[model samples]
Target: MPTLLDIEAEARGCVRCPLSEGRTQVVFGVGNPNADLMFVGEAPGQQEDLKGEPFVGRAGKLLDQLVMEEMGLTRDSFYVGNVLKCRPPGNRDPKPEEIESCRPYLEKQIELIDPNVIVTLGNFATKLLLNTTQGITKVRGQTYPYGKATLVPTFHPSAALQGGGGDVISKMRADLVRAKKVLATC
Candidate 1:
């Protein structure tokens, strides 16, 4: 089997979709490769594109704070990545073709990392991983089997930042707590 670094090396040079054209770099993933927890987000944003790291912006700060508060864990304790390694121009939502092109990379990451819990942040990641048409609001607050891991869906931190209000933040917090509960049982 290919190691995580082997897959990342290939992703860095990928031109599978139009996203590769405008990206500054591939934000493949970060944190412990052998972690029991993993966070899967949508796609890279401007900051993530520039920094070559996932979740390194205002939204990331909120994620760190909440995970620390709710699960008592930090970024080092888990791996975080986006479904699309490359950022879409102007931060637009990734197109269907873009997602399809990147699916193999994300799947390989999941297989190699082999985390016990997979936390999907936002609608795109949740929908794709669950193979469902439902949005995050409908599928969250619950866990399902994903390979050998438990899949937990939650709102993107960006949604909370985008004026989702205290209610969204509260629900996100609850989702994190729910993930923690699953982790404990694992």
Candidate 2:
């Protein structure tokens, strides 16, 4: 199997979609390759595009706090990445063609990491992984079997930034608690 580093290098040179032409860099996953948990987000935001790292922007900060402070996890203890390696223009939702082109890469990453639990942050990641059109609100905090992995769908940290309000935060915290418990049981 190819190492994450090897995959990262290949992604950097990928032109599988038009996203490659606009991206500053391919933001692959960051964190422990051997982690039991993997967090998958939608796509790279501006900060991530600039830094060539996933989940390093405002949303990332919120996620760091949730995983580290709230859930008692660390950046080095879990793998975090996105469905798309490249940023969609103007931080727009990834086009269907773009997702189709890049999905194999994400699937390969999952195969390599083989985490005990996989967390899908927001709709795009959840929809892509689950192969469904169900919104995050309907599926967040639920667990489902995906091949050998236990998948948890949750709101993206960006939702907090989007003024989803205190209710959303409370629900998010509860979801994290559930996720932690699931990890323990697994």
Candidate 3:
């Protein structure tokens, strides 16, 4: 099996789609290589693109806060990454072709990290990982089998930042708590 470093090396120079053209760098996943849990978000934003790390912005901070509060865990304890390693122009949603191009990297990540539980944030990450077209609002609050890991779906932290109100934050917190529960059993 290929290591994360092996996949990242190839991904760093990937030009499989137009996304490669505009990205500042491949915002590869970060955290413990052998974590019990993993978080998969939609894609890198401008800050993440510049930093070459996933979830370093306000959304990330909020995620960190909630995970710390609810799960008693930190980034050092879990793995986190995105569906699209490269950023789309203007922070726009990823196109179908872009998702297809990036899917292998994420799959390889899932294989290498081998986290016991995976919590997919928001629509894109959830749908892609679960291989379902259902929206996050409908699919979240549930868990499913994903390779060797159990998958948990949740609202992205960006939703809370983008005027989703306390209800969204509450839901996200609940999901983190749920992920923690799964980790315990795993």
Candidate 4:
């Protein structure tokens, strides 16, 4: 089997989608390769694109804070990735064609990491992974079985930053706890 490094190396050079044309580099993923938890976000924003790292801006700081406080796991404890490795120009929602082109890489990452739980941080990741048309509001705080791991749907940290306020934060915390419980049980 190919290692995570091999997958990332190949993803870095991907031009399968138009996104690759605008990105500074592929934000493949980052964290402990053998972690029991994984986080899947929607796509890279401007800061993530510039830094070549996912969740490195204000939203990232909030995520770091929540995971550390609620789940007691730092960013290094779980792998963080997006549905698309490259940032969508202007940070718009990723187009369907873009998702289709980039999905294999995300799937490969999940295969290699093999985490006990996957916490989807927004509508895009949640819908895609769950293979559903539902929105995050309907599915947030729920857990489902996916392959060998449990899937936990939750609000993206950016939502909290964008006036989702304490309610969103509280719910996100609960969702993180839900994922942690699943990890502990497994």
Candidate 5:
């Protein structure tokens, strides 16, 4: 089996879709490859694309704070990545075709990392992993079992930035607590 680094190297040179043509860099993932907990987000934002890393933007800052203060975990303890390595043009939602093209790479990352608990941030990540079209409001904070992993759907940190308010933050915090508890058992 190819190691994560090998997969990342391949991803870096990927030209499978139009996204690769315009991207500054492919945001493969970051943090511990052997992490027991993994966070899957929708896709790379401008900052992530520029930095060639996932979740280093404003929302990432909030996420980092939550992981550090709320869960008592740091970035080093978890793997953070996106469903699509390349940024969608104008930061729009990724097209289904784009996702279809890139899904296997994300799947391979999951296989390699083999995280015990997977946190799906926002609607896109949650929908893709769960194979459902359910809204985040309906599914957030719920846990679903996927093979050997426990998957949790939660609000995207960006949702909070989009006027989701204190209620959303509270729910996310509760979900983080659940994730931390699951981590302890894993």
Candidate 6:
């Protein structure tokens, strides 16, 4: 099987989607390749696109804090990735075509890491993984079986920082704890 590095290297040259055309570089997934836990976000934002890493912005800082507190682990202990490897211009929601084009890459990441639990950090990741149109508000804090792993949904850290306040943060914390519990069983 191709390794994660091999997948990432190939993904860097991908032109399957228009988002790739304007991107500085592919923000391929990062963190432990064999991690028991994985975080999947919607898409790379400006900071992630520029830095070629997922969750390295202000929202990422918040996620880092919560992951440490709730899971007793650092971000490096788990895998982090996005639905779309390339940034959508202006940070808009990824269009359906964009998502379709990038699905294979995300699937490859999941196949490679084989994480025991996947914590989706927003509507896009949650909806895609769950194969449902339900919003994160409706699905956050619940767990569902996905392939060989359990999937948990949570608000994006950006939501917490974007006036979602204590409630969203608390929910995200609860979801992280749930992910930790799922990993223990795995």
| TM-scores for candidates 1 onward, in order | 0.99, 0.97, 0.98, 0.98, 0.97, 0.98
Write down the worst ten-residue block by lDDT for model 1: 15-24
Q: How accurate is candidate 1 locally (lDDT)?
A: 0.95
- Whole-model lDDT values for every prediction: 0.95, 0.89, 0.94, 0.92, 0.92, 0.92
Residue 20 lDDT in candidate 1: 80
Clash count list over all predictions: 0, 0, 0, 0, 0, 0
Spell out the clash pairs found in candidate 1: none
**At residue 152, what lDDT does model 4 achieve?**
96
Clash-forming residue pairs, model 2? none
lDDT of model 4 at position 176: 88
TM-score of 4: 0.98
Tens-digit per-residue lDDT, 62-177, candidate 4: 99999999889998789999999998888899999999988999999999999999999999999999999999999886789989999999999999999999999999999988
Q: How far out, in Å, is residue 28 in model 5?
A: 0.4
In the range 155-182, model 2's lDDT, one tens digit per residue, is 9999988999677777778878877888
Weakest ten-residue segment in model 6 by summed lDDT = 177-186
Q: Could you report the Cα RMSD, in angstroms, for every candidate shown? A: 0.6, 1.0, 0.6, 0.8, 0.8, 0.8
lDDT by residue for model 5 (1-186), tens = 899999999999899889999999899999999999999999999999999889999999999988887789999989999999999989999999889888989999999999999999998899999999998889987799967999988999999988997888888899999898888898
What value does the lDDT take at residue 130 in candidate 2?
93
Residue 93's C-alpha lDDT in candidate 6? Answer: 97
What lDDT does candidate 1 reach at residue 25? 95
lDDT by residue (89-170, candidate 1, tens digit) is 8889989999999999999999999999999999999999999999999999999999999999999999999999788899
Residue 179 shift from truth in candidate 1, angstroms: 0.6
